[model samples]
Target: MPSRQWPNILITGTPGTGKTTHAAQLVEALQSSPSTSSATWEHVNVGDFVKEKGCHSGFNEEWQSWDVDEDKLLDELELVQQAGAKVIDWHTCDLFPERWIDLVLVLRCDHSQLWARLEKRGYQLNKIQENNEAEIMEVVLNDARESYAAEIVVEMQSEKPEDMEQNIERIVSWVQAWRADYGG
Candidate 1:
């Protein structure tokens, strides 16, 4: 890995764990910070991209299936390499190449809070139940560990934005330290 080359940091978690919010916060912070300016950062939300591009359709016509192209995404990883830093937002981490990732932040949410959030979205009972159960089971964290090496960090996020801010603080400092120690 080149020192000046951008670092790809993945922020993954179950739905309603605030992955998107945290990703946006981290990206904004990096762009505004003046400490180190060798690279730019971008937040890529895989699901949003898939939905926007209309990638896959399945049994539920209302809900398009997510069929991620790992190779294509890995090729896009080169964009982060060129930018020198990125905060990737995605629910699933196993889709990307582990070698290309510098760090993984797995956001976690309590099952009750997650269920409430999902309910607000008006998801079908079955989908909500499935997601709630997944959160309770720590599916996201398990998936991250199963797919990646031993450096992933897991943090919990409450329903409140303040809690999300705290989570972002931890990540911002982590990013700064990683860059200081690993960057040129």
Candidate 2:
């Protein structure tokens, strides 16, 4: 594939909203079913890379450490640009350059469901409440929308995996269409 035909897909959402899960599912689906042409799928997590590198000073004093410096993230994104047609997993979509992002999938979850998911993850009550409220307030989703073009899609994930799968399928088809339309 040509470099100019790269398709960058951004999968973002509030905490516990299934962004990573859906991103993984999308990658699997794409890889399992080969496209008519030479298109390929890659999944990149900005947060995990950041945490692995210990790039953030603010997180050093935390009880559990997960830090990704902004500068380091930019450096990693350079690799994603070259990878082409990849699914990016990160909490903050606006941090990336708009020129490289083609599609933004913002996962939204119900407050009660989100709280339950966080609780299941062993988060403290305060942390659960904070994430729930942040999601309800649309802090992350709004940030993605503000930074990207109007095509930013808002997908909802309920308490069931089936619900999540539906959204994933929708995104998969969207990616297929984009590839067809944009000459990817």
| TM-score, cand. 1 vs. native | 0.84
**Across residues 62-101, which tens digit of lDDT does each residue of candidate 1 receive?**
4424655556655655554455576788887887777668
Each model's C-alpha lDDT? 0.73, 0.75
lDDT of 2 by residue, 59-157 (tens): 643334465578876886776576567889876787888877778888788899898898899887777887888898998878887897786556455
Where model 2 places Cα greater than 4 Å from the true spot, the runs are 1-3, 58-65
Q: Estimate each model's TM-score.
A: 0.84, 0.86
- Give candidate 2's total backbone clashes: 0
For model 1, state the Cα shift of residue 181 in Å: 1.6
